[model samples]
Target: METEPLLLSTSDGVATVVINRPARKNAVTQAMWVDLAARANILSADPDVRVIVLRGMGDDFSAGADIGEFDTLRGDATSARAYEATNSAAFAALRNCTVPVIAAIRGICFGGGFGLAAACDLRIATADAQFAVPAARLGLAYPQDAMGDIVWAAGPQMARYLTYTAGRIDARAALSAGFLLEIVEAERFDARIGEIARTIAENAPLSVRASRAAIRAALSHDAEEAALAQAAGDATFLSDDYAEGRAAFAARRTPMFKGR
Candidate 1:
């Protein structure tokens, strides 16, 4: 086991979270799920973090949750629900993160791993990446908390296909289904993720966050959330970063946002 099964590193306003079990294709353990939620919550609270990227070490992103623990952790309905609750917390943390979260995927991404990717704001996978949700194969139900993300990313029909068949789909198929933002060759995968993350990090943080909030609020159809999103968007115009953006536009120079 790694000293840190999940690793976090930050630079230039982008934080990378690594699932570090390459030998097992980075399958997440129950403890790792808890750690994932904690890390996401902590990073989201950090004003310095403009973006977050989730990936795995070595060739694969993740194969999904560790099945070996199922007999103990998810052996019965009571324990299964508890286990899924932990999974839901992790998914919710990523979905609700203030900064945009990107899933940098490659190799096999299945079951819970796919759920995590679906929860992200964006997904970029290698051309050879494979995806699936194998709950049916294991004779188990998919996590309910993550269902919305899968539906939102892949649409209802595709989500049904993934869930019902438990079949593997390639990156191109996922991209066509609206699950992936883009796909790159395996060799260029890391570079592409870096480019996108940097582009987001360089943008005005307040504006980016406001946009994210607004989009989510619109989808949620909750009046309170809509109002909050409106407030956030309105606040951005009065921020120092907004002033800098306007000044830079007038000066014909790039904006340096303070995220104020």
Candidate 2:
């Protein structure tokens, strides 16, 4: 598929979606958001795709949403709603995918870029990664779902601090805030991402999908939250992979899972 603002490549059961606009520091365009969401849906439906990696082209992950598009968003209420919907759809697609999504972040990850990373199941950032949410600086309200992700990763206090300050934080600070799963030096970023992706791909797809769903549900504010955990545990216990795992352990060999 030919997408103007993004590039999609699938190989070895991993689908990599790359933000392609290097000149604007990979700032997301409206069309790009729509296309990305569509591509994500397609990948989610494909059984052969076990994982997805989101990254940016050029040196930076993303500068943020394209400021140039603000004219359309600020023009009127209808335009604003449309614009917000596009971004929300893109985020929803990422969040709702069955397969795991990893954000391989390097350099600057700001505003909408940070939102994108927050949508992923895991984030592996480079030591030099810089993060910020400048909605306050721009006098714009952060989207609720985006804010929720921040609050879920970081605490409400840290989320508020980041939003209020609109200041950049380093990779270590992000990791400390619980936003990053791992941080690696720039020299090892690519190899580290590959290793992590390979590890995820080797797992049983059914268990991974169930785990992703349960984890997201547990993060929500539902009253019966423990049900999600119970469902996840039950699903794994009932899966054929569990038996294979035990058999392999007994045989002293690695088990091959078919995701059944």
Model 1 stretches astray by more than 4 angstroms: none
TM-score of each: 0.98, 0.92
Please write out the lDDT profile of model 1 over residues 1-260, one tens digit for every residue: 77789989999999999999998899999999999999999999999999999999998999999998999999999999999999999999999999999999989999999999999999999888999999999999988769999999899999999999999999999999999999898788888999999999999999999999998998789898899899999999899998999899999999999899
> Which candidate leads in TM-score?
1
Cα lDDT, model 2, residue 138: 86
Clashing residue pairs found in predicted model 1: none
Cα shift from native, residue 170, model 2 (Å): 1.3
Query: Which of the numbered candidates is closest to the native, going by highest lDDT?
Result: 1
